[model samples]
Each structure stands twice: as C-alpha cells, then as structure tokens.
Target: MRNRSHIHQLFEALAPKTEQKEKMLQNILVQSRNEKIRHRGFAPVKRLRSAVLAAVLMAGLTTTAFAAAYMGLDEAFLKFLNPVNHEQAQYLSNGAYVVDKQVTNENGTLTIKQVIGDSNLTYILMDFSAPEGTVLDAARYRFLDNDITTRQNFQSVGFKALDDGNRSDNKISLVMSVMTRNSIAGQKVHLRLKDLQAADPLPGIFETIIPGTWETEFKLDFKDYSTLYPVNQNITMYGYEAVLKSISVSPISITLKVDSSYLEEINEAAGELKEIGDNKHLDNFPITINYADGTSETTAIFSGLYLSEHISEQILMIKTFENVINDKEIASIVFFDKEIPIQTGR
Candidate 1:
C-alpha cells in the first residue's frame, strides 16, 4: 500500500477549496478502511457518497472478470474466457474448480459454480437456479471473516441470462470479489446473501420481493501467485501523451495503472473538478492486456478517479481482472492501436 501521508500531500496540493479537501480526505479513508485508523468530522451525505463511490470503484476494479464485452455462458470449463479476447467471463459453465457446496431455500439453489483468487482478491462464480420464470433483479452478499469473526468489504458484479425474447429467467450468473489484499488460503470463508428482489411481470409495478437469507462456506488453495512492475512507457491517445505506470496480475484479479500527461494541463487551470469524470479525458479508452500465452482481456477503469494537479502524478486509471493472468507472463499491452511490450524492469 502507498503511504497515506504521500496521498494527503497530493490531495493538499490539488484541492483548492477547504470543503473539497475535506471530502477527498474522507474518500481516501473510506476506501482504505482496512487500515487501522479513526476518521473524524465528516458530513453524513458526504460519508454516504464516499462509501457508495468506494463500492463502485472497487466493483469497477473487478470488471476484468465481468464486463459487457466478455459476457457469455457454456464453455470448456478451463478454457480462457473469450479465447480470442481471453478477458472477462472466462469460467462460465466449466466445473473444473467446482466446490459443489450450495444452499437451497425458497428463493432457489445458490450453488458455488467456480472460485479463483490470490492474496489481494477473491473472485467467485455462483449459479442461482430458481423456479422457471423467476427473475432475480438484484442481490447482496458478503464473506464472514472468522479470524476477526466479522464482515469485510468487497466488490461484485452479476449477469442474469435473458431469454430469447430478452426477458429475464430463473438461472442467473454472478461474480463477486472479496477485496482483501491478504492470502485467504486454507481459510473457511462464510458467505451470505439477503434481500433479493425479482423483477415484476407488470410493467410499471415494483419488483417481486423475495425475503430470505442464503448462507454457505467455502475456501480456496492459492497454488500460484505472482506480481510484476512493468517498465514505465510512453503512449499517445486522444492527441495527448500518457504513461503506463504499472501492472498487477493474479488468478483472482489483474490491475493496470495509467497516468495521462494531458490531464495535467487541464488540472493546472485551477478549475473546479466535480469528480474524475468531469475531465472526460480518459473516458472510453479501449485498454486491453495481453498475456504471454497470446491472450488478452479488455479492462474497465475504476470509477473513483484519483485527483492530481499534475496529470502524470494523478493515478489516471486503475484496471483490474478476475481471470487469472501471470504478470511475469504478460507479453504486451494494446491501447488505442499502440502495442506496448511489457519490459520486465530488469
């Protein structure tokens, strides 16, 4: 983890207003709650906003596993997800790593379909088989940490397989991440879900409410894990220069950090920055990661933006993956038609 003081210094330099500075500080604290520190004096709305943004950012961090581009079902279990893109939604129906542990209640049978992870994160694929015509519109889940015997924060995403008419169905697929930067090997994790709401048949009515709780426990053995710091390289996009700062890859997650030089000019203007999106500089950049195995996956940028007076200093983009990729095995990165080879900083 980076030094909080260093982060605070960067915040102090860029934030012009006292309120903005306070809000930024609150966001940092909210995202880094795993750190043992007490925060004081924050408006309730601001706190709630920061917490929601943290979940969103964390969820975005897991898009490398589940995204619009790599959504599909039925595959040869261990086959790399998109084979061509080899990016998101890799473990669709393959049961190579199936735990077979599940819970069945009135809602449905919540079965653990697949599991993958490392110290930094845990990615889970669950299959929900309900009565026919069932529509699981939304859900919530968490892992019970026994060492602490408490709950921890995580990021998640889900896809409900629609019918031929594009209508909802009983079988739904979900992928979730427990964003703990520590190894969960040989540890029993208690998982739970509640307050599931289903889509209503009537057009303008509320969703069909399902009131019940589903719980189960499972674990993963970390057979392999590795990390690499790629040589900082230069690239151009949207008529502006940027730097590919670093890359972190694992079975559960992969992360890419990009810094844009052009954004610095905009930030230096001392203008108001409603949020990272206000700049609209790094939006819709088709960023893809290529592994040594000749496979690549498109990544989603973390929604919560890192603010900076200098574009190069600002953590412009953070992309994460749920599919396993060895960082040391990374071959190249494809961004905006530019193929940047990963140079092991030897």
Candidate 2:
C-alpha cells in the first residue's frame, strides 16, 4: 500500500489502541528478522498475533445497499461500487452460489462463503475471523499466498473490499473478495492460504500482521455464466484501425480481445504515429454495452490487464461495469460510435 497523504491523516485520527498496535507490529517484525539472523538454521519461525482490518478502505464508510443478511456476489461488489440497474443486479444475485466449506485454526476461521464466475474471471467471497482478536482487514491483512493454485497453472489474485461494519477488533463482519484471472469456472480450484500477514501498507498507515497457518485445501464450485462469441467488428480507436477480435461475457465481467500491432520492432523511421494506435491507447477505448431493454451502460476499463500467452500478437482489454451484466439480455456492444448487434449463440 503506497502511502497517500490522506491515509496518513486517517491513521493519526485512529484510536490510541490501534496506533500502539501498529508500532508494536513494526517492532515485532524487526525483532523477527533479528531472531532469524541469530539462529543457525532448521527452525520454524514463531508466528505473531493478527489484527482485524475493520475499515473498508475502498468505500471509506459509504454503505452500499445490501438487501440480504448474507451478501451474494453482487452484494459484495455493490458494497464498494456503484449500484447496477435492477435487472442486471437481479442476474448477479441469481448466479451467486454458496460454498459453505470452511477451515478453522488458533487464529480464527476462514470460510469460503460463495463463488461466482465467468469465462475470464472468478469472484470469491471469503470471511476470516479470529476469537483472540480481529486479524483480517483490507487496511492490513492478506493471505501470504499471492496466487491461487489451479490444476492448469497459478492464477493471479486481487482483493476487492473488506467489510467495514463488523464488531470485533478485526472486521468481525470482514468480507473480502479474491478475484482470479483463470477461466476455471465450474472446475475445482485448490487454495492454500499458508497464513495471513500484513498487506502492502500505505506507508505509516500501520504495520503488524496476524500470523498463523490456515493450511486448508478446498474446492471452488460455482456457476459458470460466461458465453463467448467471435466479434469481427472493426474498431477505430485512437485512430488505430483494427478488428475487434472477440468477446467473452459473464455476469461478473466482459473481456475483449484485440490484435496487437506492437509486435513490430521499433522502426524509428516509421514515425511515432504507428505505435500510438496499439495497446498504448486501449485504456482510452470507450465501449458501451447496450441491452435489449433499451438500457445501456458504459464500461470502466480495468486498470490492469491479464497475462497473455501470445503477448506480442494480441492484447486482452478487460472491462467491468459498475453493476453486473447478463449476456442474454445484451442486444449489442457499442464500440465508440459503432454498434455491433449481439446474436446470442451465434
């Protein structure tokens, strides 16, 4: 967590107990490092106490409309993002499937509450609780493991929001989403949460990690809401004329594949104009999803991109909606001014 100026101010205003805990954590990490140097070898490091991150950093206290006691995939996202239209919201709600499986240890319990997916993304709701103290929070705690191991390969993962309104020192109501890149929907996903530790801290925000191995192996079973269709639609983005490769739609997100023109070696004589049209300007692509009902929504292109097998030949531009979207209800996708009609199953 890079320290933004505002985050430091917020920490200064935190409770004294929280302040002390942060200092204590920094000192403890230093102490741990020293201990490691002193020891010869062949010894397991002792773990430290974990803290609950009650503050949902993304929403900053904005409460989303969560209609149910248990949040579905849509509710989890809505808690920290813009509200979707009624119909799209309903589709998201129906697609969410429960995965009540959980694992408990001395630190607390880590439960896999629910999971939902599309062809390119997986959204998982996880709850971590500690009886001794709150140990999981977006502000500070995260799984030691970086990627979710799949039978095929290791998939990159990211955190969405931490539940803000829980009672425990940690978010007693802590809810976190682990989004993965692999298209492993409807298949089993092997998760090894070695331990929870201090997340990338917003410098001076706080330090101190909850330590304990919740070495639990579980399977992720969820509904696959993705549909793939070839889209030969021509696009003129940033003046780069190229065919829109294809699209994969699911309730969670939409992915667009575009041909990469950057593969050519830098030709200084060709002028800078050639490179300008490539993926360099994809972030500026204005795409809209128009539904059959006459409603349309603009996409918020995701900041980061997934790894591509053929990186030199093509680029994958990921787009997400403020609210969830259903594929069947989609009538066409508008790329800039051109509207490409979507014929389901075609």
Q: All models: lDDT?
A: 0.49, 0.55
Over the stretch 1-346, how does candidate 2's per-residue lDDT look in tens digits? Answer: 2223333333333213776879987986786577557653634432211111234423433443222212344333445332234444445555666676688877678777776666666767777776764545445556656445665443456554455555345543333444344477556656667556554445423243656665444555555677777887766555555567788776557777766464232122223422333223233455788887888877443333444344456656566554455567788887754677776531
Candidate 1 root-mean-square deviation in Å: 23.3
Q: Residue 115: error of model 2 in Å?
A: 0.7
The clash number for model 1 is 5
Cα miss at 120, model 1 (Å)?
A: 4.2
The Cα error of candidate 2 at residue 307, in Å, is 4.1
Report the poorest 10 consecutive residues by lDDT, candidate 2. Answer: 45-54
Q: After superposition, how far is residue 255 of candidate 2 from its true place, in Å?
A: 0.6
Error of 2 at 170 (Å): 3.8
What does the lDDT come to for candidate 1? Answer: 0.49
lDDT of 2 at 315: 53
